[model samples]
Target: LAKTTQPISMDSYEGQEVNITCSHNNIATNDYITWYQQFPSQGPRFIIQGYKTKVTNEVASLFIPADRKSSTLSLPRVSLSDTAVYYCLVVRYNQGGKLIFGQGTELSVKP
Candidate 1:
């Protein structure tokens, strides 16, 4: 299993761009990088995922370097409602693997 590390907390103002990065130095070849966001008392919601390159969705973008050791989740122009705890996960799908969640980075979006 690849151990992932991320910031403990982050702060940003409303309508500002926020980028949270995760480092997985021992990531495996078959492992795919995924990110999730959770509000207080709510389950984590999927934000984005990437294999090797950049992947962009309507809400956020995921950028992975060539080495696949790290990935970044970028939220464009975040609002006050975006304040939540963000989780970074490394998983191998189709293998019945359990999802292990680490202490996520708490993002505080202030107005």
Candidate 2:
């Protein structure tokens, strides 16, 4: 699998919805799309995961295109407390659950 490309930063007002998208044009057959949320000074928290179509959970929704080349993570009505960095990762077994943190997309929620 290849590396993912995502935005460097995004800004949203409080109570607004935010969507972050990433592209992995060289994604492999065994790769899965996973989203993680991280606040400053803390580890990334698993937000959602999907291999195809849509997967929704309590915190977010992950929409993966059929080609498995890209994915979008949707956060509904984000608040100031939701300000954090969001990461899109290509899940690979060889990674040993060790995340390779890229320059994550910084999500800023303004009051």
My TM-score estimates for the predictions, one after another, are: 0.97, 0.93
What digit string (tens of lDDT, one per residue) describes model 2 on residues 1-111?
A: 569999999999988989999998988887788888899899888899898999998889988888989899999999998899999988777656555567889999999
Screening candidate 2 with a backbone cut-off below 3 angstroms (N, C-alpha, C), the clashing residue pairs are none
lDDT of 1 by residue, 38-108 (tens): 99888899988889899999999999999999999999999999999999999988576567799999999
Best by lDDT: 1
**Candidate 2, which segments miss by more than 4 Å at Cα?**
94-97
lDDT of each: 0.93, 0.87
Candidate 2 positional error at 105, Å: 0.4
TM-score for candidate 2, please give it. 0.93
Lowest lDDT sum, 10 consecutive residues, model 2, at 93-102
Residue pairs whose backbone atoms clash in candidate 1: none
Which residue runs of candidate 1 sit more than 4 Å off their true CA positions?
none
